[model samples]
Target: MDSGIGSQPLQEETADLKAPIAEPSINLDNRIPGLDDPYEHALKPNGDPWAILLKPEMETDKIQCDAWKEEVQTLLIFAGLFSAVVTAFVIESYKFLQPDPNDAIVRLLTQIANGSNATSSPASTSFTATAPSLRINIFWFISLILSLATVLVGTIALQWLREHQAYPACSPKQTLALLRMRSESLEAWHIPQVFAALPLLLQSALVLFLAGLIDFTLPLGPKISIPIACIIGLILVFLACTTILPSFQPLFLLSGRFSRDSVPSPCAFKSPQSQL
Candidate 1:
């Protein structure tokens, strides 16, 4: 009976040893999932998770760059149109004064003297009649040169952007570098655009002033020419400032960050394993 009891205990112990240990139960709900987990979709072959995240950022940057490029193209077109207008106007005004170019030239000189002496002589009145033509020619000449410069610089920038777009940077580091370089180049190109506006503003103001001068020279009494010219000048100034200023904000932000001699590497955050 004792052997049977002892054997029973031994059998129980043997049974306990043979039984599998109960593993601690895990709460799947509380467990954080990882990208490599089987439940998640598999990554693409040779694909980088970091690169995938960066894709959207790169796309956004590309969109902004394209928009800026279009803006520059529009500015170029406007510059060309302005150049054409100035050239045509100057030519026409020169032809109009050709009957006696010396008369307009003499009139311009006389007017400068008359500015010092408020009272005008009979000869001064005759000279004043031709002064508007000379002033118009001079102002338009300056405007033409400025507008042409804007067109030239804008064209160069546009072509460079096109080429860059065609042969884009292959890697993220290259892309970041290219974007920074393009922004600086764009800022430089924008200088001509902003300066072009100054000449345009001056030319428009001169146009209005000439209208007033011509009014005095005309047999007819004061007319609406000055008011009309003033309105035109205001419109040109508004358009130029509104279009150019917004572009500057973006370029300024971009350039200010990368202006230093030592640019931070885009791959600085990458792991040594990734580099290998």
Candidate 2:
């Protein structure tokens, strides 16, 4: 055998061995299309869940804190102003608690002048505060105290809100967990209930003041007292309706809409008359 003919079979075998082999005709993708990458990615576990879950929780905490802070601040301002006004009224009303010497001297002088001009003796004056004055002072003093108390409550609420917003230095995950815990504590302690009662306290003080004012004015006769009473009663009615009717919501719109009204929303069920 010459080299050419003898090497032909070997050359053919070499050519066969050199042929390109098919790669992975049956691969992971072949078994199930497009599932392998997700399985691998899931096993790796990225930071997406941390951001996605915690972000809303943190934002919810912030929104609640800001809303309460603003409301408390506004209530504080009203309480301060109301206290000042009530204090001014108290300053005048309290003087009636004790007999004023200056007032007595003036009354004496007036009686002396009247006695000299007329033949009759000047009638003895009662320097002591009458029942109406005592009642008036009591009501006004209570109102002033209540207003101050409201201010105190509002201040405490502000502090609570501030403390609620505060967080320890920590990682984001820890921070969010801490916030949730604090919020639960806040509710558990009835901080929201305390906040809810603040307005009611303030309103009670105002009602007491008005009651005292009405009592003080009643001596002026029906001409003065009737109109004053009517006006005050009207205001009280309006305020009461406004406060109570909001609780009824879609059931009672006569008091107008509130923060949680369904004024714009259509009724879910049509009436039989409407269907007709």
Q: Which structure among the candidates has the greatest lDDT? A: 2
Tens digits of per-residue lDDT, candidate 1, 250-270, equal 566667766577754442322
Report residue 276 deviation for candidate 2 (angstroms): 40
Task: List per-prediction Cα lDDT, in the order shown.
Answer: 0.58, 0.76
Worst 10 residues of 2 by lDDT: 267-276
Candidate 1 lands at a TM-score of: 0.44
* Candidate 1 segments whose C-alpha is farther than 4 A from its true place: 1-46, 96-130, 166-221, 224-227, 233-276
lDDT of 1 at 148: 69
lDDT of 2 by residue, 1-276 (tens): 598899999999999999998887455554553412334336236664545677899888888778777877887898898888888888887887887768656766776776664445445567677899999988988888888888898897888787778778776657767877898898899887787777777888999999888987989999999999999999898666665544455564555545454445544333222221
- Clashing pairs counted in every model: 0, 0
RMSD (Å) of each candidate, 1 decimal? 16.5, 12.8
List where candidate 2 sits over 4 angstroms from the true fold. 1-48, 102-128, 246-276
Clashing pairs in 2: none
